[model samples]
Target chain A: MSERLHDRTRLRPPAPASIGDRVEDVGSPALLVDLDAFDHNLAQMQGLADAGGVALRPHAKAHKSVAVAQRQIAAGAVGICCQKLSEAYPFAAFGIADIHISNEFVGADKLAMAVELARHVNLSICVDDVRQVAAMASAAEAGGVRITVLPEVDVGHGRCGVNSTEALSRLADAIGEAPSLRFGGLQAYHGGAQHLPVWVQRRQAAQRAAEAVDGYVRHLDARGVSCPVITGGGTGTAEFDCQSGVYTEVQPGTYLFLDGHYGASEWLGQFRPRHSLFLSATVMSTARPGVVVCDVGLKSVAVDSGLPRLWSRDRSGWLRYVAANDEHGVLEVLNGDSQALLGSKLLLVPGHCDPTANLHAQFVCLREGRVVGLWEVDARGLSR
Target chain B: MSERLHDRTRLRPPAPASIGDRVEDVGSPALLVDLDAFDHNLAQMQGLADAGGVALRPHAKAHKSVAVAQRQIAAGAVGICCQKLSEAYPFAAFGIADIHISNEFVGADKLAMAVELARHVNLSICVDDVRQVAAMASAAEAGGVRITVLPEVDVGHGRCGVNSTEALSRLADAIGEAPSLRFGGLQAYHGGAQHLPVWVQRRQAAQRAAEAVDGYVRHLDARGVSCPVITGGGTGTAEFDCQSGVYTEVQPGTYLFLDGHYGASEWLGQFRPRHSLFLSATVMSTARPGVVVCDVGLKSVAVDSGLPRLWSRDRSGWLRYVAANDEHGVLEVLNGDSQALLGSKLLLVPGHCDPTANLHAQFVCLREGRVVGLWEVDARGLSR
Candidate 1:
């Protein structure tokens, strides 16, 4: 056990960047996380959580870095929430004592591994079905370990979980009665609602989610069960989740590193949190008169929400980014002054942060354009 | 240097599987490469290359695995092509003597690194302008190294490269005159034409690309410059490229792992090469009657080409994949006793293989449903 623990400790080494080196000197298409921006966003989210008197279990699935997770833990966050057993085990093995898998795990082997990991930490697994509950219970019983289980209630997303509070009650009751399982309140996440793009829509969605979760908590309370925690919120509706009055905990992932899609929100615009994450691509081609080719493509950043916004100065409005092949992004140069020559550096703000981070092995942590640190994305590729 | 080398060796430990463990026993949403199918595709592409008498430089950016590149090298492939300097360095370091960067690289540090890396292997980089030529020449001269250079010609793809043969001739002249560079011919890749969806359109696009490339080659040849190696083709246009007499070599990246987009081609439909790659997801939610949630999401796979197709049998057409949040994918069941309960597994064929493969750290190589090998994506995050 000591040997396995020691081996896992050195999972990722630091990236190729020395302190005080410029961001352009690091590498092309490298994931850059501005430390100043990250710290500001972290404090902002923590402040919101504190004001509501709720625990902050920021989703570790966003950055997938132990360094970021530890920073959150240091800043009054109770724990971190991972999305898979693979992600949860690494945190547990890395000595993170409190870890909750905000998603579900299936298969006997996966559940068994989750149960084994639970023996090392305060582990909570989510389930929306009696079958998943029974599997978790069986795995826990087999491992001779008690596991915390959460019943997910689908608020707005028709993707998973019980649609109603009544259905959630049955799953919660089953979890409470399971032989080796302890009921951990709820996983009431409105995933689709988080990207609604409108302030009122997102707030209303969070309000509805909170109300539905409270209804389930009431149902469980009347049946002699107590709700200890309720965690479900994302970067989009973090404020609404906090102000909803019933949520004891709000899980907001993407708050530390805002993407263009989430950053477009009016609420987020008011505070003006820095764009913490960026993809630094190089101008790979400048043969054409009015177009330039960049190195960041679909392989380096996600385009699900939209094409990445050009974050480079002096060329912002003059360059239009068009998603091309897997290895290239074409930027149309609108003016003569916007001459993006070969070897010139261009920074891109990813359309979505989570998947963009997943494309990188480590973050080139910068401070004012200088490389100050390197954070290994320890849980990267942690999707089971 | 040895210490850093040792640390890099341990970057990724063996994935959770021995030689004979079942696929389900491994992990959910893990990248799986069926070895038998992979071998078949490798041989199939090799056979085409042999028949056409053109060298096959299978683009390593598809799998990013040294294992896959080595197998290609073993199977009559002359070399491998990478899209970035960072991607090429790992292959060269892993003992691939011949490596080509199919795209232009920018930034001084990156160029210097490429020059340094070239000292250990046969490195060839692409350029489409005189500025890139001067930069490469300066770097190579400073490093006291001789490097191979390719001038890219834009063949109907307005993304990158010189648009006309006149421009290509000028660039070729510059490459041939560079102090520390050897003019290695042209990169005529029409990326836009690779996914025309229609057979005749794809073929015509390839023909047009070849005609334009030949015209440029003739232009260079007329000026007493030798076009030694003309390289460019892709999984979507491999046959068309081989049949075209102008291209001395073809770079086909995705042939070994046919995704749904490329696999939908009528020409590819003829031979029916095995779908070598897959994303295995677990049924995380079974609460809703007609829908089930899987662990694979936007982070686990790319949705740029289209949503992934359900590859598992008995429920293939019954389940329609709907992309949800970063952590979940919803599958709607159409009909029948295709009961996908929690813990039950489903296999998905990615819409596009390259970007999806980029999301994974390692490929869980399987044969007959059992783990056979673990291939670390040596250049997975080498997108610098």
Candidate 2:
């Protein structure tokens, strides 16, 4: 029993890969980031944001890594956007001065978090209702901190935010009335419009969203209210949004790690999204002919957008991720040798980067086919 | 700057709920387990396994909580099955002396974990290939641990395991040759058949799997190899698997907390699976007339099986979770009041329990509409 207790004490799960280890030696089902491609993506997005004259506030909800956010800030991002109050904790702790909660949140607990976060950073949060404003203002006052309040306007997303100008005005008025709150700007984001697949459809969606934002801005202007910053735009529609002249700041999270869904989209714009993130999965089973099962599945990668695409250097398309169970990803070997593939590590570009990144505890930072570092997905599962 | 640093030091995300908080007062997008229903589920599964005369080894992959596993152990579960080596860490650390890795794994890292775990616990792992056997044997021998090897046979679960008795015999021989290995019987599981929806179909599938197991056992018997345990079953087929008389032990994970997918299935069996688990989501947005968005989405719940069903006490079907974004669940109000739902906490029955449970850090344990305790999701993202 003493030995058993000692053994238990010594049992620690091995890290996916040590620093300087080759990519092939990394453990299966690891979240991997190609540092070269990541750097390229960072420079590219920064360049685009610079040329377009828009403040880049890359959403940290996609990576949830302080390292990634720090790199983004170093590359000239004005701030970072987090979808939840808890998600912004790590970035706040890491001393990222500006963080925005890009989604609506309620409850005293969330308000308390917002207030707490406001004390450390230039914390901003979105709200679509007057009740939320009152609660947030009360918490901010109680905590002796001022919070930037953005009234999210439904710019054709139809998910969250006020659709009507009256509702928007009410929220803006409420924020303006609160002494501890500053009416920062409008959160006019059309999340659904970001992934229309076709370039023309996405452009049209962005145009409609821009028009809606213009209307909301004009309405506020008519009421002698100056909208300081209009924050809303994702990886898909950032190019068009920057050209819209309506959004002062853009939040493009997936731009850093272009996923299978984004890669499938027609990118006629200047923003070149290279696939930087990958699920390093090993071909665990090759019992059946023409089929191999990898160690990645629903737990390792998100299938909300679609099954991950097998990332091949030559775009061979020999192996296709056919299905995903809890801990197994079934891949159909179209023309490759399944036997030879056994025990070999394969890179999978996830369907959705945000949720897929949220699945892993850390990202194996890879450079020149070797692990350079491991970055903790610090705010992972911080959905509250 | 010092004040900011001090504030950052104090910035910690609050717990979802305190020990004595009311159910409604708990934070949004929290994983909740109804203790009453959970206890009922525990007793029911135990009763089912007891009556069937089969040892119950509940799968911990569904609820990776040590507290839940402890409860299961106290309630009569022989052991627990974790899919990944890393996932079994907390349970083993918490003094779970018996554990089974019910899936095949590769890599030196995983083998090392297997050997290390074997030292403290009765660690049994599944394998389909002879190559895996040699590596595992070497690791176990070097670690000075006797690791039980279960040769997984593909009983219609085409994902993993050997299809033929010849291959199975080869694996068994490989285990027999290994000094630090024990041939612990077969892992004949059909994961795809678990959610067949129809009872007769599931029963037929279970029977076919039983026949397959029986054939494999006979092949081993012909070689004078005694198969002490034949373990393979899940919530959907536990009833039929136990009755098969072929399986000495049945592994059912989801029976303790039935998800929407399992709850939707036609259960004509004696095992009464109850809905114990829930995703506590708050209606954060009610801007649209008929549509309200909750704070639970891809980050909070798994939508791989299907979108989460709104769990209402009255079963009025007033609201339907139609779509899920990264952090938002769009619920369409069907003949109900959207305004009334705003700021109200709604219970969501996840589409799938395993992956959904993987998303949260802790489960807000509830008893009679009050928060009783908070159980950490010990192995929340230990996919590696």
Candidate 3:
């Protein structure tokens, strides 16, 4: 075990940049956080949530950095939401008292992890089935930890959560019967509605989701059950969600670091998202005419949403990231000299921030073209 | 620095499976290697290389594990190829003396890394530009290291490398002039031809690439330069590449762990690749009828080549992984009950093995339903 640890310590690459280094000195394929924009986005989202009268729990799954999470907490966030039990560990260990695992889990291993985490922090989990409730209850009871349970009601996401009111009621009753469980509220998240592209469509989707949650809440109220918190929403639909008057808490993760996917979406609301995250890549090769390959590719950025866009301050659109291979991102020089771009640093706005941010070990926080600090991606590769 | 190290130690999640643990006991979204099939792949690839009379230098960009690389070396592999200079550090530190950076690099940071690596191992790197050769020569001279330089010639990949024989001659001459640089040979890799579904198309592409490389070799020969090595070829075209009588060595990274993309390709040759790599996922949600959500998703697997395919023995096509979100894989139950699959484990053949392997911290090696070993993905995120 000691030998393995030694190997790991040796295997880790040096951080891309150090404090007080120029932005160009940062290594290629590093995740860069524009601190100025990051701070603006943070305060902007907090103000939006405050104005909407909803508790703001930024999803830690987006950044996966304890430093970012601490900033979010300091910026008036109520708590944070994690998509997995293992992903909640770093936040919990770093003085984060409240965390909600906004997803479902099963099996003895996951149950053990959940119960163990409950011992350290105020842990809440979502469930859509009676079996899951029973298993979590058993594990929580055996661990002597009270786990706040949220019956995930399918508010039109159609992926996870109970579809019907009866199923939600059954899950709530099952949690109520468990001595170590507390019925927190409802998990009404419409993941599909987050990126509808059309403003009216997004608004309507959020409205339907809110209506479904309201129906579930009314059903619970009729059964003499008190619901305290209703948490849902993402960066794309947080405005509509908070305005729906049905959700008590909103979880907007990507609002702090807008990506190409969200940048292409229609934004008519007051919550203006700034592009805080950028992939610092170097032009590695300019062998082909009119085309240069950057160091960022499938391993450095996520392409599921779409290819990353080159960050252009003047919107010149001179360089287009056309394709991505495993270790090379092929960029076509629309109107610039490819040779001049060689060895030059370019900032890229990743298509999707979540998976792209997960690819790097640390974030090179930049302020006015100078690296101010480095933040560890604390929960990277913690998909378990 | 000590505080940061402590935080990193606390941030890392526990390994999914300990040695000798049951296969089912492994945590969800863990990279699993079937030892029975893995050993067969290792021996089979070596046998193929022996029969073809070509050197087998497996690309470490695929598995990125020292244990796997050590096994390959023990099975008669010549050396190993890494796509980046930073990636070669682990292999060098772990006592692997021969390493090749089979791709081009630029910038002072990359040059420093190359010089540092050359001081520790027999480091070989590829270059296509004279400017790159000049920079590398200066770095090697300053570091007092003799670095092997391979001129990369474009042999139909159309992404990197020099295009014409004139360019190749210039690069070779530049390398020969450098006092600290040894003109190793040529790098002619047709990455685009590696995944053609039709066998004939792949063969023709390999033939064209071989012919182009032969032309470059003749050009070098006419210039009174003796090329010691001609390296290039991936898993998809290794068979044709070795028999072409041009390539002295082949770098077949994915041959050891056949993926869905390769499985879907036509293999009319004797190289019977086996599916040894798998993503062990468990069903976490069965909320929607006829569909079950597994814990494996974009964070756990690479979707660049295509979506992963469920591994089924007996041709039972009961489950299909239809969609992947950030943290959930939606599997459609074709003929089986979704409820029965809840909390059950399923082995998934990743679409592409390289990036998928990069997503995990370690691989759980399973032999006869029990974990025999855990191999760290030593250079998991060393993309720079």
Candidate 4:
């Protein structure tokens, strides 16, 4: 312990790289993505979808980049599922065809933007109200494009979507009446199920959601209306979604870059993807004997899930992200005998991936610990 | 309650702006700041600093806008406090003369960036260790620039900083020894106190932090050394900071845009400045009897503090942001008759203002329901 304290872990050794040094050469709190791991995760999801006879519509909201979406499509994804139209705008602009806004949009202005996007790409959107259908119709008419409509049905989680079949039919009928809109299917997603943590809890929740969708589909069929599609699923419950056999397409994101939170589970899966997001912070101060302060903080990383886990430490010291500031991260030397020397670089696996991805402008994509590519988070900060 | 719903509160109605409405004119979810109220908050803080005979170094992390910084400086702020060197890059790039990065910086690459930044702006950065001091000095020598250094001290928030005056003095001595470094004062910010909700808790926390600074200052005085600047205070404890006689400058950022979380508090003499951040999300679907789904969801508005409160709505309907998809917000309309009609526009006050502000690219600054200016969130997505 005395020897470890003498060799502080938080102080990263001087990584003296010239300005021309590739992005990867600049070490940890850097985000590292193993391309092999990423491709395996992608292929596994695709294979699962193909085996289940379902279309893979990967959600781009998890990884809000056109580059990542293009890769998903290359891996046989039917299209992309975007949570917001603003998020879809950039993807659509990048020629990501068959975009489904898996959320409801209400106002005329946003509807117009969606319609405008539909003109350039194949667009499908979800709605939980008749008025939203009318607004979409008007906007699509103005934009001279036909938009596919999915009536969002609440399958639990108590968020958005129609609570009952009656409300779903009403919204569907409203869509049928709109000249510029076509009934796509149904969006039956229970978002709360994604973070169940326990495999049994997650599976049960997905089964319950599927049961709700089954009821909705049967109700529509009884009324002589065929619901062509049922799109919903996430990384946390994609396997359960496929097993349920109710959802026609799964919108699983974050599988490409499994974060610390998702990785914490003991679920059996072959897709061990790499983390692509990082808050490359430097150790700024080490005045305290047992602690080291870093340049990254609350602003640098999203701590809603939990603190970042110390990734890739070569020393005896187990570094912990004990606290954070808007611009500083606190690393505590938990083990006195640990050798995480001062100025020694260390990787941190973020707790939650999505919010962490949203916190950056560009992803410094790496391969074999070398700077291979850099993709701009095109839809980042497009909150409108 | 029924009468209140029909009372037609004096809040501005959603303005129907066309697509041609130059980036500014659109209504709902737009943050409207009473500039007069803002100026008053600025002056009040400055007056306290003047009366207390202390330096007023406002934290720029709250506003993150160059324009706002100019206003703060105009109201008598000596210098601005930033959390990161990168966060301060934009302010420095825009020619905001003086800056103090209230956190430590460690990596050589980042140190070089700071050194590069110091070439233009008058910069002071915090340090918690000797190795970091060496790195900063190396970067400074490489860039041929001098940097002011402040040793971060741990008062509370066990996050970062040193606990001993001996360690602080040692780091200060190390900083002074550096060819391109100058020893500044101390940074004793109690981060945990910022969200105490209760004013007394916040005050008591600040008092303890002040006591730490007093210890350091007395030590410095005994050594025949004069510590000029002692910076650290946030929006929550800024009032108590002015009263404490310890903090030379108080860094409060959230006062410009009081969000639901901050405004929900009943702190004495605490002024409610104008709400300056909004997520201009459109209602996407409203088919359900008592629910409205919006285009903005977890991707658009952050729920780190909690879900955003529906702004300008009457108590007739208790609006709860019950769910969030990537692009959809599920607002549960509870109690009485739901006042939210289909396609009706609504404003939402975010739980935490900073992350929400960081989520947007532009600020549609409004006055009396009319767009006056469009400020780009320049430092937004600068998470790296």
Models, CA RMSD each: 4.3, 2.8, 2.1, 9.1
The order by descending lDDT is 3, 2, 1, 4
lDDT (10s digit) by residue, model 3, range B1-384: 113313322433567999889987999899999988888888887887888899999999999888888888889988999998888888888877799999988888889888888877789999989999999999999999999999999998899999988888889889999999999999889998998989899999999999999999998899899889999999999988878999999999999899999989998887778899999898999989999999999999999999998885532388899999999999988886788777988889999999999999998988899998889898888899
lDDT of each: 0.80, 0.89, 0.89, 0.71
Models sorted by DockQ, best on top = 3, 2, 1, 4
Summed backbone clashes in each candidate are 2, 0, 0, 30
Worst 10 residues of 2 chain B by lDDT: B1-10
> In candidate 2 chain A, what residue range of length 10 has the lowest lDDT sum?
A1-10
Q: Is the docking of candidate 3 incorrect, acceptable, medium or high quality?
A: medium
lDDT of 2 by residue, B1-384 (tens): 001223346567888989878888989899988988988889988988888899999999999988888888989999999999999998888788899999988888888888878877899999999999999999988888899999999999787999998999899999999998999988888887898999999999999999989999999999999898899989999999988989999999998899999999998878777899998898898888998888998899998889999887763378888998889889888877787777888888998999999999988998889888888888998987
TM-score, candidate 2, is: 0.96
Candidate 3's TM-score: 0.97
Q: lDDT per residue, candidate 1, B88-199, as tens digits?
A: 7667766778988888877776777677678877999888878888888988999999999998888887767888777777787787788799999888899888888888
Per-residue C-alpha lDDT of model 2 across residues A1-384, encoded as one tens digit per residue:
001223346566788889999988989899989989999989988888888899999999999988888889989999999999999998898789999899898888888888888878898999988999999888888899999999999888777888888898899899999999999999988888888999999999999999999999999999999899998999999999888888999999998999999999999888877899998898888989999888998999998888998887652468888999889998998986787777878888999999999988888999899898899888999998
lDDT of 1 by residue, A45-106 (tens): 89988987888999988888777877889899999988877776556655667888887767
How well does each candidate superpose onto the true structure, as a TM-score? 0.94, 0.96, 0.97, 0.87
Candidate 1 residue spans exceeding 4 A from truth: A1-16, A268-272, A337-340, B1-16, B23-26, B268-272, B337-340
**Candidate 2 C-alpha error for residue A83, in Å:** 0.7
Candidate 3 chain B lowest-lDDT run of ten: B1-10
Taking the tens digit of each residue's C-alpha lDDT, what string does model 3 give over A1-384?
213313422443567888888998999989999989999999988998899899999999999998898899989998899999899998888878899999999988899889888887889999988999999988899999999999999988899999988888899899999999999999989998999988889999999999999999999999999899999999988988778899999999999999989988888888888899999889889989999998999999999999998896642378889999999999988887788778878889999999998988989999899998889898998898
The top-ranked prediction according to TM-score is: 3
Off by over 4 Å in 4: A1-24, A27-30, A243-245, A269-281, A313-317, A337-340, B1-34, B193-208, B243-246, B264-266, B269-291, B322-332
Clashing pairs in 3: none
